[model samples]
Target: MACVYSMRSSLFWMMLVSLTGLAITGCATSVSTTTDKPRLAQQSVLSTLWMDRAGEYRALCHQAFNMAKLQVDRRLSYHRTLEKPLAVIVDIDETVLSNVPYFSQLIDKGEVFPRGWKVWMQMSTAQAIPGALEFLKYARFRGVEVFYISNRSINEGLTATINNLVKMDFPFADQRHLLLKSKSGNKQPRRDRVEQTHEVILLIGDNLNDFSLIFSDKPVVQRNNAVDMMSSEFGKRFIILPNPIYGDWEGALYDYQWGTSSAQKLKVRQQLYNQ
Candidate 1:
């Protein structure tokens, strides 16, 4: 009886060791698999940092606005009289508002867009882009109509956007001058709508598409070529702000392929670095 009990005890100890070994192996495999998971959020870390912390970023924004003031002054001086009222068209995101906090949150949690975008919009805590408020106010003071043309969807972001702009003391934050995206992200139609009543002297944005449909949905080569072709208009009629974070430029890398997997996007970005 004593020998049998000892043998049973030894068998129990052997089974426990086998089960522990299997558990450790499973954990190792799980960890190994997670290493290949999507790292898209990490890619924007430097961009977010630059936008949030770099004085150069602020200087660039100030430079863009300063140039805008110069151009607007030039236009007003050259065309003292016109058939329509002088107007300036500008994009909302990245042009007039700094969304650094929202982007910083994404970097912290390794998340992507539309995940916290709506929440951020609703928060209405975004600050004015450097020199943006002052520039817009100057335009207003000079009797130039300020029109905001944004791709922010009407359904999800209209109210919050208006509220945020209004709260920030931006000129012309009302519905009449603030045009939100409806049924399309292409802003050409809205621009045309504004042009009907006002002579749009200047257009400002961070994305090339914000200026024209020519840059919309195009691949990298064509987009670059288009910029070169329209080089003369830049800083004159088309005032562009710097946005190194996310933009159509990044989308062009994927050939404008929307809804691509994070892993696939990361792979494309990596390959571009090698080139």
Candidate 2:
């Protein structure tokens, strides 16, 4: 009778454990089934197109570099000062460094600017832009000084940026050559510092602020006017790289209100679109 009672108790406990396991499994399965599916499947169409035309994109980069070289030569020739030492100011992200992978990651995660940008910069896994390495090498061999002027905040990812650039074997990877933003978004002070010592013959970047910080926070019409005023300088003293991902142009359209909520921003964008 004692043995029978013990067997019955064990059976009861085993049945209770089995039932509990089954209940937990059912709940998990139901929760998973109720989860929402991803809206857009696969990579973004724009990113796919960019990847497909990468070869052409690279060729264009080479062409742009060749043009820049020619312009540099002309400027030096015009000045007739071979000993003056030519200098080129380049923007880091999206200009000389390719952050397509980072952008793709953001798209895959269904994320956008500010949050996505902070993550991308923190990752600091940006590769050199196509043909940029070759151009920098050529420029170095030709005795031209290279400087990188980026708007990335100095407080964030500063060390990571240095390490990533060094890892990529970028020319002028020295700390002195890198100029990051201080507390202010204004870059003119930094540009002025570079201009004080160097001639700054060529300005290469994917953004307008990279050329002249004056137009950094200007309105759309004013920015357009500023560009028109300096039209001759562009493609001559300035070589712009392509960056369709994000730019100040978008900021201008949104009135540069980065503090505004996404819903409010979207409403403003919708109104502009309707106009």
Candidate 3:
């Protein structure tokens, strides 16, 4: 397991460095009116987050899974029952498969999402996160059913996503267990489907939205309060992976309004800590 994970880690860097170089060149300029500095700044930060060998990016992923394993052990010793089948629900994209490469590819071309998104998904070359495969396999070994509940569109990226998971040797990569995004983008319905027969012990993902709909584009203060509200459940039943490069958390900064300029985003962050 150590040897294979190390190899995957190496492959991840190789792709990141290659794609970072490509993005630096591709996003040298954009069709949008946003200045070069903002695009250039985003590329720099994203590359550093994705490419750094010794960084918080790697450390946080490791921490999340370490805690998840502990959480699972505690759950079994203290809470689980034989009444229903046990399951661990996980989001697909950055939670299990590191889509930083796809994000890099998109930024490299200086293109936006909905344009290159499907292309990247079809390529389906995302590598598994460092501890995700082993931890999830551990869950299954403990008699837990692993159900993937991703917000990825149902008919669009489902097949490629499953293929990606299978290629990474993740267990339970099948249709019945793979629930995709419905038109609502709210996952509770699909989660409801799983709860009918399985007791979902852990909900794992990089984004809060992956665990519940309450996180959908709320105000920044409200979102923080919500996290505080469920603080107890975080490490126990909600395992959140780290994803600094992109997520709804960042979207909340700009009021969830699409097409907000990069300068505007910077301005908001600048004010986040002002007295």
lDDT of every predicted structure (CA atoms): 0.89, 0.75, 0.79
Ranking by lDDT: 1, 3, 2
Give the lowest summed-lDDT range of ten residues in model 2.
32-41
Error of 2 at 274 (Å): 2.4
lDDT of 3 at 262: 58
The most accurate candidate by TM-score is 1
RMSD of each: 6.8, 11.7, 17.7
For 1-275, candidate 3 gives per-residue lDDT tens digits of 99999999999999999999889965553334545334634554554456435476777888888888887787787654657877889988778888766666556655445556787787878898878999999998988889999878889888888888899899999888899986877788988899999888889998998887788789889999999998998988898987767778878877887686555555566678583
Of 1 and 3, which scores higher on lDDT? 1
In model 2, how large is the Cα lDDT of residue 214?
62
lDDT of 3 at 12: 100
Model 2 reaches what TM-score against the true structure?
A: 0.76
Total backbone clashes of model 3?
Answer: 1
Q: What are the models' TM-scores? A: 0.86, 0.76, 0.78
Q: What local lDDT does model 3 show for residue 113?
A: 51
What is the model-wide C-alpha lDDT for candidate 2?
0.75
Show the colliding residue pairs in model 2.
Answer: none
